[model samples]
Target: MDIQKIRRDTIGCEQLIHLNNAGAALMPAVVANGIRDYISAEETGGGYETADKYSAELDQFYTYMAKLLHCRSENIAFTTNATDSFNRALSAVPFKQGDVILTTENDYPSNFIAFISLQKRLGIEIVTVRNTPSGETDLEDLEQKINTLQPRLVSVTHVPTSSGLVQPVAAIGNITKRYDTLYLLDACQSVGQLAVDAIATGADFISGTFRKFLRGPRGAGFLYISDKALQSGLEPLFPDLRGAEWTGIHAYTHREDAKRFEDWETAFALMAGSTAAIKYLLDIGIQEVQTRNETLTAYLRHQLGNVPGVQLQDKGKHPCSIVTFSIANQEPERFKQYFKQHGVNIYTTARSSAIIDFTQKGIEWVARVSPHYYNTEAEIDRFMQLLTAIA
Candidate 1:
């Protein structure tokens, strides 16, 4: 793949140093133009008429997503964002009293809160697996927990938002398969940065967003439910008309496909834009993207490691593109503002985001810089120079 040509297609890099891809990636020109054209068509014609005109392109959304995840189109469901998909998938599993939910300490805050809320309401038990000394979840401990607890469900985040540490998801998936446990994977950070195959991952369900690494619109996401899950008659807590059809006064029928988790109305423009974005990534190739991001992150880490009083917080056997660090005498927000003033985009994470992981590591907040495939080595060098000057 031509790396320079790919970077040139992302116009935002010319205006600002965007290192906040973990938050939201800049949309490529093709994706932006696609969304604008769809909106213009809607204004010129009626909503229904405009949809009819681009029905084939809109349908490609599911096809492209399935191709990306290496899953069947029937197993995919369109959602507004990762949170929406995660919540919908979680709601589908019925949690009775004393049911156990085994998760990781590095899980996203929203997911942790959701489990806590469910536990409070339904008398379910929430169990968090211990993390290793390097901040990744301990696979041995996780297996031991599963053997002992025999939990109702097993869920984990492939790549956590708070840090760049990649969890041992495939190992966990192997364990789940051995015991016939339901596995749910939150791939919000890993979907575009790494190869994701639902069957290989052994996950019964997976959820992710398009705006992060996929560089799509902000409100586009998806969910994948295995055929076995569908066969088991798992449906959302509150199924809409699109998800279920009212057969009679006392009966309803849910769709056999993963669309059973989705609602009737959706943002068609965003859907089209997401499809274009996936096509753009496919054109560049995911393996090439991963290689570029890993190289950039390693360069960034090498430069940042030399900064005075700066401590890299992310520790794992293998890391992705997220670079997180904390300065000895600087506040996270103040440091972030310094970077902003210098035209470098970054973000800060508090202990509340990953409370168990942060507190265990004795960290309050840290500055995070996440780079994508479009980011160049020169940009990483410049960011490091700026960090040194500020420090």
Candidate 2:
């Protein structure tokens, strides 16, 4: 990896010690310029006119996303964000009364909320699988629950937003496949930073966002639908005009492809930016990016471990770039203020976000510092110096 070239392309890293890639990485010049130019064209040529002129570039988003996930272009659908993608996929599952959704406690908070809402509205049941002592999804317990419960769908988060713990998604996929149950994967924080192959996971549906690790513009995400789901005729319950054709006064046929989960209108400018960002990552290679991320996080973790009064809150044997820790008797907001004052970027995860995880850990909040491949060891060292003095 060309560390200097990567950091040079990432202009924000030059201005600040960026440690919030999991929230939103600094967009490289190509991506930001792509978005700016598209918006400029939209302002001058009109939205519809600009979309027509750049239609091929907009379509390339799906092609690039297919490359990222190792799926056919027809299997990808565009959405507003990862949660939007997940919700659309969830809507496609033909939930009946008393249907069960088996999931993990460390799942994304917003997704768990959606499950609870589904339970209340449709009388669906939600069951959480047990976690191991180190906080990974217990595969043995998950398989046991699937055998006894016969769940309608099995959902898993590739990586939760609060921490860097990467769940054994591929292994869980094997379990879901063995049970012949539908699998939904939330790959919001894992797609660009990890080599996520849809074929290897065998998930029926996978959701991802470009704004996070992909260094793309906001308001754009993509979903991957397995050919199995397409052949089974699964689609969003309320398909839009873009998703289906109106055959008659009261009839419509959904698209044969994954676009059946998409809406009629979208931000074409954001699509242009996302196209550039995904192409950027594809050019660099995901495995190389993952290696760089592991190196940055390993250094960050080692530095944080040595800070007095600092409690490392990350779990799992293989934590990713997100480093979560708390200073003794220090409010999360204080950490935020301190980092802001020092021109260092960081984020905080609160108790409300990860109910089970935070409640069990006996904490209300933790500081999340996520450094991307563009970040340098020097930046991590500078962050450590600031943190050590604060401690």
Candidate 3:
């Protein structure tokens, strides 16, 4: 691996020990500088003129995202963030009265709330599969639910926000395909940390943010809609001129691609930065990055487990880069603040962020420490030493 190139790209290593990659990975120099350059152009040229001047670069955003997710460029749409992308995709699915929407218990709170709100409004039936003993969605229960209910949509988070557990997305995809159910994957945390092939996952729609493991600017994300979805005429709830053409006074035609989910206005500067971020990740090779992240996380977990009074909260047969834990008699916020004071960055997850899972597990809050490929093993050792000292 080109360690020198990686080190040069990431400038944050010198400043702080960042362990919140799942929340927002540190942006590389290229992405930060790209956004600055775009903003400078906007000052010299008018906003509209600047966008026109860099339209090709903005267009490359979709192309780069498509390559990252292994889908066609036409099947990709840029969104404000992962939540925005997820909401848009959910809105596109026409939910009728008595329709069933099946999901896992570990689903993100925002997504769970959206489903409940839609169910109340549309009178749709919402079903949640039982979790495995290990904290992941039980495959047997999921298969049984699909066989019985034949849900209108099958949604699952590739990686839950509260823990390091990675759900069996490929297996779920196989089941969804067998039943011809519309599959939607929430890949907010898994996109850049793991290899996400929309085709292999068999998800008709996939939503993810660039800020997390992608290490891009905030307020930047993308969605993937399979060709089959486009052919089936699925569209956003409010399609604008950019998404659909005004054919006549009372008629219109939606685009033949995933662009139908997008609006006209966007942050061109952020899009440029997102494009640069994607290129940087691709250059490093995602497979190698995933391996590096896994190794770092494993080392962190092992060290944390050895610390007195520190209990790792993540439970699963296979885990990702996220490491959740709690120290005895330590409030989540206080613990996080302690780390912050020591120049270490981490995040706290309250029950509200993942109410269903946390509430069920009797965990009110947890401290999350997530590492990316750029993080070193030495950082993990230092973090462990701090954790031990605190304990």
Name the best candidate (by TM-score).
2
Q: Show where candidate 2 strays beyond 4 Å.
A: none
Evaluated against the true structure, the overall lDDT of model 2 is 0.91
Residue by residue across 1-391, what tens digits does model 1's lDDT show? 6767777888988889899999999999999999999999999998989888998989898898899889899999999999999999999887789988999988889999999999989999999898888878788988899899888899899998888899878778888988856899999999888888888888989999999999999999999999889999998999999899999999999999999999988899999999999999988888988988888898888888888989898878889988898888888888888888988899999998988878877989988999998888887887888888868
Between prediction 1 and prediction 3, the one with superior lDDT is 3
RMSD to true structure for each model, in Å? 1.2, 1.0, 1.2
Clashes counted in candidate 3 amount to 0
Q: Give the number of the best model, judged by lDDT.
A: 2
Tens-place lDDT digits, model 2, residues 290-371? 9999998998898888888989999998999888987787888888889889999999999999999998899998899999
Preferred candidate (TM-score higher): 2 or 3: 2
Which segments of candidate 1 are over 4 A away from where they belong? none
lDDT of each: 0.89, 0.91, 0.90
lDDT of predicted model 1: 0.89
Cα lDDT tens digits, model 3, 191-278, are 9999989899989899999899999999999999999889999999999998999999999999998989988998889999999999
- Candidate 1 lowest-lDDT run of ten: 1-10
Residue 199, candidate 1: alpha-carbon lDDT: 82
